[model samples]
Target: MIIRKATHTDIPSLVILMNNFRKFYQQESNTEEVKSFLKERMDKGNSVIFVAILEDKLVGYTQLFPSFSTIKLEKIWILNDLFISEKFRGLGVASQLLTRVLKFSQETHRHQVWLLTGNDNKSAQHLYRKIGFTNTKFKHYVYNF
Candidate 1:
């Protein structure tokens, strides 16, 4: 498997995975906004995307958004999205994509990386733990209004 940063040319595959990610969350939206949305982020260097390719096919991806941490007084990243195609689930693709981000954070001296998943996603929780991520004492709540 090959792991690398995403380019504009990779948008189609990225959009596909992102749409799947949303579906996994029980959202019904399509990839309608992905192309232009990702283009803007990529063009401005506001986010980072990494993909896992096996035999020239994309099977997984991780998207991270950069933000500052007032508490830590430094820049941090929110690994806002991660997805591995259903067909590639057990192939360690998720681990590979996450490891790339972990390495990238360390190399760049970032303060931290954060991500959240559904409470019922036991498998992903296990994977997160295996990757050195721990459960926080605080709860996450979102209001979509």
Candidate 2:
């Protein structure tokens, strides 16, 4: 298994996984929109995406968005998306992707890495805790436009 940063050529595979991820979250899947979104981010260098490849097949991916912590006066990474293909679920692909994220964060001197998951996603929660992420006490608030 190889985990590495994504390039433009990886978009098709990414779109497939991203669509599946959206469906997993009960959201509508739009391949063109997802591909365009990822392309824009990659073109603008606005986010970091790591993909897991096994024998030339893209099986998993995790995306991080750059942000800052005013309180800490430092940069942080918001791990906004993570997904492993259904057939590759039990093979530690997600863990490998996460490990790459953490290593990237540290190498880039970021203050921290954080992510949000559905409250009902016990499996994800378990994987996160196992990977050394702690649950934050703060509540999340969002206002959709």
Candidate 3:
């Protein structure tokens, strides 16, 4: 297995994985929209994505969007998406992807990395805790437009 930063050439695979992730969250899948969204992020250089490969096949990915903490005055990464194909689950793919994200954060001198997953996503929660993430005192609230 190999894990590496995603480049423009990997957009097609990224789109597929992203759609799968959306579907997992019960969102309607729109390939074109997903492609456009990811393309914009890649073009603007506002996000970092890592892909996992096995036997030359793309198996999984995680995406991080850069942000900053006003109080801390430091860079942070919002881990917005993580997905592994059903066939590729249980193979440590998500764990490897997260490890790479943390390594990148440290190397870039980022102050922190954070993520949110579905409340019912027990599997993901387990993996996150196993990898050293913890629940925080703060609650995450969002107002969608």
Query: Could you tell me every candidate's TM-score relative to the true structure?
Result: 0.94, 0.97, 0.97
What is candidate 3's lDDT per residue for 1-145, written digit by digit as tens? Answer: 9999999999999999999999999999999999999999999999999999997989999999999999789999999999999998999999999999999999999988989999999999999999999999889999999
Q: Give the CA lDDT, 0 to 100, for residue 49 in model 3.
A: 93
Segments in model 3 whose C-alpha atoms lie over 4 Å from true places: none
Provide the clash count, candidate 1: 0
> Poorest 10 consecutive residues of model 2 by lDDT?
65-74
RMSD of 3: 0.9
Task: For candidate 2, write residues 20-101 as lDDT tens digits.
Answer: 9999999998999999999999999999999999968999999999999897899999999999999999899999999999
Q: Least accurate stretch of 10 residues (summed lDDT) in model 3?
A: 64-73
Q: Give model 1's TM-score versus the native structure.
A: 0.94
Index of the highest-TM-score prediction? 2
